[model samples]
Target: MNTQQRTSTLQHSGVNEAEVSKLFRNTYSLLAMTLTFSALVAFGSMTFNLPHPGIIIMLVGFYGLLFLTTKLRNSPWGLVSTFAFTGFLGYTLGPILNMYLSLPNGGSLVTMALGMTALVFFSLSAYAILTRKDFSFLSGFIMAGFVVLLCAVVASFFIEISGLQMAISAGFVLFSSAVILYQTSSIIHGGEDNYIMATITLFVSIYNLFLSLLHLLGIFGGDD
Candidate 1:
C-alpha cells in the first residue's frame, strides 16, 4: 500500500530470488563434477574387469556412504561422502554394463538407454524451471511409489517373475522422471536450500533413470 512498505517488500523478494539462483548454480556445478568423477570411476572398473561386488556388499556400501553424506550434509565432509556414494554406485554399474556389452547389439542398447535418460532428465528439468510449477504435492506419491517398487524388486528376486520385473522398471522410469522435476522445482522455489543435498537428489534420480531404461532396453532389444 505505502511506498516504504512496497520498497521493502521488493528488496526482500529480490534477495530471495538471488539466493535461489545461487543455490541452483551451486547445485548443478556440484552435480556435474560428481557425475564426471563417477563416470571415470566406472570406466576404470570396467577396464579392470572388476567384480559386481555382490548384492550384500553393494547394499552395505551404498547405505553406509549415504548415511554419512546425510549426517554431514551441512559440512565439507558431505562432498566427500557424496562422491564416495556415487562412485560406489558407478563401480557396481560397471559389471552390469560389461554383461550388457557381452550381448549382441549391447552397445547400441547401452547408447540408447543413455541418450534417453539424458533426454528425459533435461526435458523434465527444463519444464520445471520454465514453468516454475510447484511439484511438492508429488512428494507423497514419490515416497509411496519407491516403497512399492522396493517391495516388488525384493519379491522379484525370490519369485522370478518377468512381468513384475518389467513393471518395476517402468515404474522406476516414471518415478525417476518425477523426481527430476520435483528436485528442480524444489531448488527454484526455495524449498531446498542445501546444494549438497540437491546435487545428491538429482544425481540419484539420473542414476536410477539410466539403469531403469537400460533394463527395459535389454529386455526388448538385446539378442538372446
Candidate 2:
C-alpha cells in the first residue's frame, strides 16, 4: 500500500482500539454500579419480607433481561438490558441474603462471599492481561455446561440430597471460574467491543462463584 493508505489504515485501527478501550471502561463502571444496586435490592427485600411471588417474578425477569442483553450486546439496548438484569438479580438475591442472615454465623458468610469475589476477579483479570489469550473458543463448552447445570438444578428440587448439592455447587464454581476467564480474555483480546455485556457476564460468574464457594465452605467448615 502507498504511504497515505498506510497512514489511513493505522488511523482506523487506532480509532477502533480507542473505541474498544472506552467500551471496556464503560462496562466495568456499569458493573460496579450494578453490583451496588443488587446489594441494596437484596438487603431491602430481606428487610421488607417480600413475598415468594415477587422473588419468582424477579428471577424470571432476570433471565429475560439477560437474554435480551446477550442478543443486543452490540447496541445501546444491550446496555439497558444489562442494567435491568442486574436489578432483577439483586431482587432475586434477597432470599439468599435473608437465609444467610438467619444463620448463626451469617457475618462469616458475608466475609467469605466478599473474599471469594475479590479472589476470583483479581486472579482472572490478571490471567487475562498476562496471558492475553482469546477464550471465545470456550463459548460452546460453557453453553453446554450451562445446560447441564440447569438440568441438575431442576433435579435437585426432587432429590434434595446433600451430596448432590455439594457436587452441583462444585461444578458451578468451576463453570463460573471458566466464565470469568473467558469473559476477561474476551475483553483483553478485543473479541468483545461491548464492555457492558462483558462486565455483566464476568460479574455474574464472580457472583455465582462466590456463592458456590461460600456454600461449600459452610458445608465443610464449622460455624464458629
For candidate 2, lDDT tens digit of each residue in 1-224? 69999999999889877886787788778888888888888788778977445535756786778888889888888777777787777766777767766788887887887788788778887887688888888889899989999899889978877588888899998899888888877776777777767777877887788788778877776542
RMSD of each: 1.1, 2.9
* Model 1 / residue 120 / CA error / Å: 0.4
Q: Candidate 1 lDDT, tens digit per residue, 70-182? A: 99999999998999998998999899999999998999999999999999999999999999999999999999998999899899878986478779989999999889988
Q: Candidate 1: where are CA atoms >4 Å away? A: none
lDDT of candidates 1 onward, in order: 0.91, 0.79
lDDT of 1: 0.91
- Candidate 2's C-alpha runs over 4 A off are 1-13, 51-59, 70-80, 222-224
Query: After aligning candidate 1 to the native by TM-score, how far in Å is the CA of 45 from where it should be?
Result: 0.5
